[model samples]
Target: MNDYLVKAVAYQNQIRAYAVNSTATVAEAQRRHAAKPTATDALGRSMTAGVILGAMLKGEEKVSVKINGGGPLGTIMVDSNAKGEVRGYVSHPQTEMEINEVGKAVGMNGLLTVSKDVGLMHPFVGQIPLISGEIGEDYTSYLSKSEQTASAVGVDVLVNSDSTVKAAGGFIIQLMPGADEEVLNIIKDRMKVIAPLSSMISEGSTPEQLLEHVLGSENVTVLESMPVRFQCQCSVDRITNAIISLGSEEIQDMIETDGHAEANCHFCNEFYYFDTEHLQALKEVAL
Candidate 1:
């Protein structure tokens, strides 16, 4: 099934929840970056959480998640908007390690930073030390400490024997400010008994089913559902604009020295090549 996310409220709107099925979305990132199993899990989990966080916003708002856990995976970065579009990459996509070792591969010594751009003069940024190096726990810590919301986050990615992603998804459950202790206890109890998220995803569970599993079918009231996918905002025109901003001197230098200019987007791994003729055109525009 195509990837998608669902927003819902449970226990008479006392709890806010978001869930996503990100299998295809993560598969795209794995294919683009050629990420190994460990890197795939790290990137997939972060992207899953990032997209759900994005769904919390409105209009043109967006969020960016950055994780550097001081391990072999290096850095994992993901960007997502309220539209359910997301893109991400890992610094060392080829890092080799056993599956389900994302914590060790990601280490426990760095930080997870979230920046939200809500059309403000400056984006709001929050940073918290990594509590577990596991993407889900780190995000849970980030939400509780940075956003000051009591939240439970569960993110998982299952990798096949061939390094392809078998399933990738996650859920975020947050308690509203007026939530009662009984509601909190019930949620905590339910969380302790739910099947592993990876297993549920591998079994073809939908985002709605995932939420029902955690929040109970009777309690969850679906709010909105939207398709989500791997979507990079990079394009040749944007790259061209960046080059034009470098000034005519820089464009001329590229034409004289290299005969061509090539730029690769880190998020999508797409290359933009500008032949000498293209450089001349941009130089004129720069002038």
Candidate 2:
């Protein structure tokens, strides 16, 4: 099935929730980055959460998530827009470890930062220390400390022996201001008994079912559902504009030294090549 996310509210609007089935979305990322099992897990989890967070925005708003744990995996970065588009990359795509060594592979020794661009003069930034190096807990911490919302985040990815993603999904449930203690206790109890997000996803649970498992079928009222995918904003036209901005001198230097210029996008790994003739044309336009 194609990837999608669900927005919901439970307990008469006291609880705000988001859930997603990110299997295909994350599979595309794994394929693009050639990520190993550990890198796949880290990147997949972050993208899942990032996309959900993006859904919380409106219009052209965007969010970027950064995870640096000082581990072998290096840094994991994810970007998502309010339209359910997400793209991400891991610094070290070949990092791998034992199945149960998520913390070690993620190394709880750095920070998690989230930046939001809401068409403001400056984007809002939130940073928090990594408490677990596991993506879910780190996100939960960020929401609580940075966003000041008490939230429960569960994100997981199942990787096959061949390093392909078997399943990827996650959920985020937040307690709004004035949330009653009774409601919080009930949600907590339900979360304790629910299966891991990856396990439920592998068992073919939809985003709705995942949230129902956490918030109860009777309590959750689905608000919106939208398709999500791996999308990047880089393109030949954008790259051409960038090269032009470098001015005629830089374009001429490229034509003289390299014969051709190759630009690779880190987000989607798309390559754009400009031959000598193309450089000359750009140089003519560069003022």
Candidate 3:
């Protein structure tokens, strides 16, 4: 199914919820980055949650999530926009480990930082130490510490034997300021019995269905839904402009030495190749 996310409120608007089925989106990232099973799980979960978090913002806002856990995956970076577009990459895409070793594959010794570009002179930056190296709890901790909001975040990814992602998705439920103890207790009780997020997605649950499972069909009122996809804002023109900014001398050196230049986007792994003629043209426009 095409990936999408849903936003809702439950129990008379006492709780705010966001759920997503990001299987195809994560699979795209895995294919672009060539991430192994463990790395795919980590990157997929992060990207899944990141897109939901982006949806929480208003117009023109964007978010960047960085996870550096001191493991083989190194640093994992994901960028998302309020429009439900997201792109991500891991430093060590080939890293793999046992299913039970998810935390070990993404070490718990570093930090998970989130920076938001909310149309301000200065962007908001919040970070928390890796509490579990599991993407879900870490995001839960981030919201608790950074936004001072009580939240439950469950993100997961299931990989097939050949290292392809079979399913990827997650849900985030937050208690609004006026939420009561009764509503809280009800949600807490229901959460304990809900199926795992990845398993639910694997079973063909839509984003709305995921929320229904977590927040109850009777109580959930779907507010909005949007399609989500793997999107990167990198292009040959952008790369060419960057090369031009490096000055004519540098451009001339590239033309004389290599006869061609290649730029790879870290986010989507797209390659931009510039032949000597392209470099010469850029050199003419350089300062």
Candidate 4:
């Protein structure tokens, strides 16, 4: 099934929730980056959470998530917009490690930074120390401490034996203002008994069903559903503009030394090559 996310409210709007099925979305990232199992897990989890956070915004707002866990996986970065488009990469995509527990491969040190661009003069940025290198817990911590919202986050990715992604998805549940203690206790109790996130995704659970699994089908009031996917913002034109911005002298240096220039996007791994002739045109434009 194609990936999608669902937004919902339950218990009379006191609880707001977001859930996403990101299997195909993550599989594309794994294929693009040639990520090993551990690296795929880290990247997949971050992208899942990032996309859900993106849905919380409106219009052209965007969100970027950066995680540096002081582990072999290095840094994992994901960008998403309110439209449900998301793209991400891991610094060391080929790193392989054994995972005996939830946060083992991601490590327990470093920070999770979230930056939001809301068409403001400066984007709002929040940084928090990683409580657990597990992507979900780190996001939960960020929301509670940085955003000051009481939230529960669950993100998981299952990797196949051949390093392909089997399933990837997550959910975010937050208590809105005026939420009662009774409602909070019920949600906490339900979460304790819900099936593991990976198992739910592997069973072909939809985003709405995932939320229902945690929030109860009777209580959930589905709000909106939107398709989500792996979408990179990089393009040939953007790369060319970046090269031109280097100035005429730099373009001349490229032409004289290498006779050509090539650029690769870190997010999508797409290559952009400019021959010597193209470089000369860009040099004229720069001048």
lDDT against the true structure, each candidate: 0.93, 0.92, 0.90, 0.92
lDDT of 4 by residue, 1-287 (tens): 99999999998999999999999999999999999888898899999999999999999999999999787788899999999999999999988876524376677788899999999999999999988898898999999999999898999999999999989999999999978857867887988898888789999889899988898899999998999999999998898999989999999999999999998899999988999999999999999
Stretches of candidate 2 exceeding 4 Å from the true structure: none
Q: What is the TM-score of each candidate against the true structure?
A: 0.97, 0.97, 0.96, 0.97
The alpha-carbon RMSD values of the candidates against the true structure, listed in the order shown, are 1.1, 1.1, 1.3, 1.2
lDDT of 1 at 128: 98
The sequence of per-residue lDDT tens digits that candidate 3 reaches over residues 1-287 is 88999999998989999999999999999999888888899899999999999999889999999999898889989999999999999999998875546778789999999999999999999999999888888999999899899888989899888878899999899999978857766776887898887888899889889888877899999999999999999987788889999999998898888998989899999988999888888899995
Query: For residues 5-123, what per-residue lDDT tens digits would candidate 2 score against the true structure?
Result: 99999999999999999999999999999999888998999999999899999999999999998988888899999999999998988888866466777788999999999999999
What lDDT does candidate 3 reach at residue 234? 95
Model 2 TM-score, all chains together: 0.97
How does candidate 4 score on lDDT?
A: 0.92
Best by lDDT: 1
